[model samples]
Target: MDLSALKQLGMDDREINLYLALFQLGPSSIRDIASHTGINRGTTYESLKQMAARGLISYAPKGKRRVFRAEDPDKLLLLAEEKKSALEGTIDSLKTNIIPGLHHLKPDFSAGNVRFYEGDDGIETVLKDILATVGQQTDKEYCVFSTKSIRHHLYRPFPNYTLQRIRRKIKVRVIAVGDGGEDAEYSERKWLKTDGPVDASYIAIYPPKVAMISMASENYPVATVLEAPEVARSQQVVFDALWGFL
Candidate 1:
């Protein structure tokens, strides 16, 4: 797991380090946590203070010093739940503040360029938009290049989608680079095991547009939407060549 991702989960550097140390070491003193986490005494004390306030740790006075120990592991789950509740509350507050202003505003009548989206829901919105595009297609024929090994792991909702598309007469062609390829019951799908580089990035080209998904990269999931007529035409050409080779 990425330390940056953990930080995004509301953990400061020293707090994350100390928490991870406690998780690994079971229960230990602040000095022991500092030794394992490589955090300074002052930082450790501050982190412990914050953790205790968050109901993450407990300590008992022992002679001249206090012996700190991590609380139940379930406290992490509780913390996560609390964070989720707080975020929902914040979103509700923002919507309450902004929705009336939004209602008073007029829609943008001017044309715009590309839009950037963030987070998992944003990614899902992009995917649903692409699927809508495919649904709009008259003689739907789409092809995608992907990794079979990991597609289902991340896209568990995909199978039912393609099945529905197939029912709608949309043709699907997926070329996976490993075993257990694209979903069954989808049309024109095939797999090939290769030593060549194959991973989470996948390219999907439809008649009117081409989309490339960067799924495994550390950055946010992104797909570029191109409207250039010539670009789409050229991509279709390249897609035809690859489709034939596959």
Candidate 2:
């Protein structure tokens, strides 16, 4: 009854309409189908031809005219299964063909590479990707700037990740706006607080990547990630200098 699912099976709107029409009307001529479904004769005939070839419908001649009927409804399940199997086989072939070639593909920033993520999911993805780039450091230091009221938002993501960094003896360096130095109390991570308008346009340096997040001002709260070594190194040097002087 839900014909929408058939869309994934590559059935177009006209095909779905015709199939549903046939299911409801039983065996019928193209003219009858066209009249019943409010489709024109030419499109109805063309759609029926493809449906017959896909084994979704059948046509039988009654004298000089042909009547079209829906195939067994159970075959819909079979068609779905066939589509799944085909996709799985294609995926396996693609994996065998593509992944090995991926090793040769290097990040080329000169060719221009950047991602824009919007909404909460986009923000979360930027955070997760930054975390993944952290290497085996003697200390995992993070310099973050956030808009007002920092709570577990700062503390929770670090423990499990910090455990990995800490196994390598990596410590964290956090510098947030006023009173944020206290929020990271749950972990061994150190914090330094400064006074600023912690509302929007906060920049973060998490090694190899610099992320800037501006949350829903006049413009949408989208994230931009730049993955160039020169940019990252400059940010790193600036952060280290700020951490030392502040």
Candidate 3:
């Protein structure tokens, strides 16, 4: 198993090592912990102090010495919960405050950062970015102009992508250029009139990013993500206008 996940809960390498040392040794002194982990005394003492501040480790009096020990390992779950709560707050702030203020700044034409992805992995990357972004918003929906070319390539590599989207409560409004997307929960589709199948391109217009996938090439599937607030807003406006007509 990856021990690096402990870093996500805000513990550094030395801190994690110190905690493990204390846990294994069962209420060790700072000196014992330093000795066990091979970390120096000064560094170990500082780490224990920081960990105690975070409630990851605690101390008690044992005779004339102070004993330090790890809290229940399950306390890591509290870190996860705190992280989730903090992320939700940040997302809410972006949606409500930060993003709206961004419009007043002059549009940087150079801000359109285009990223290209190759093969099935590229398609997966684009889809996951869309899912993560749309999942954060209160609106929780994005607009897609999908075609057979993109669908045929993506469904194989990311068959569970749709189920994952639903689990995240991310919704999509799609304009199927061909035929046959029936009603599904958290999704709405409309068929748009097109001649000769619209050349097999898929467009997903989400806030601050617009993703396009193509399967027209013989060798591999390809995708591009364009991140520009103004560009995405323009695409969204067009999608909304067309959606109204449909």
Candidate whose TM-score is highest: 2
Candidate 1, 101-158: lDDT as tens digits:
7644734331332455444555566566667778877766777777754465335434
Q: What is the C-alpha RMSD of each candidate to the true structure, in Å?
A: 12.7, 7.1, 5.7
Better of 1 and 3 by TM-score: 3
Q: Which residue pairs clash in candidate 1?
A: none
Candidate 2 lDDT, 95-177, residue by residue in tens: 78776566347655644456777765676677666555554343455566554443334323333544554554434456554
What Cα-based lDDT does every candidate model obtain?
0.68, 0.70, 0.84
TM-score of 3: 0.59
TM-score of each: 0.47, 0.62, 0.59
Give the poorly placed runs of model 2, Cα more than 4 Å off.
89-107, 114-177, 181-189, 195-201, 205-208, 214-223, 229-246
RMSD of 3: 5.7
Instruction: Count residue pairs with overlapping backbones in model 1.
Output: 0
Q: Per-residue lDDT tens digits of candidate 3, residues 73-104?
A: 88999988999999999999998889888855
Provide the global lDDT of candidate 1 against the true structure: 0.68
Residue 170 Cα positional deviation in candidate 2, in Å, after optimal superposition: 17
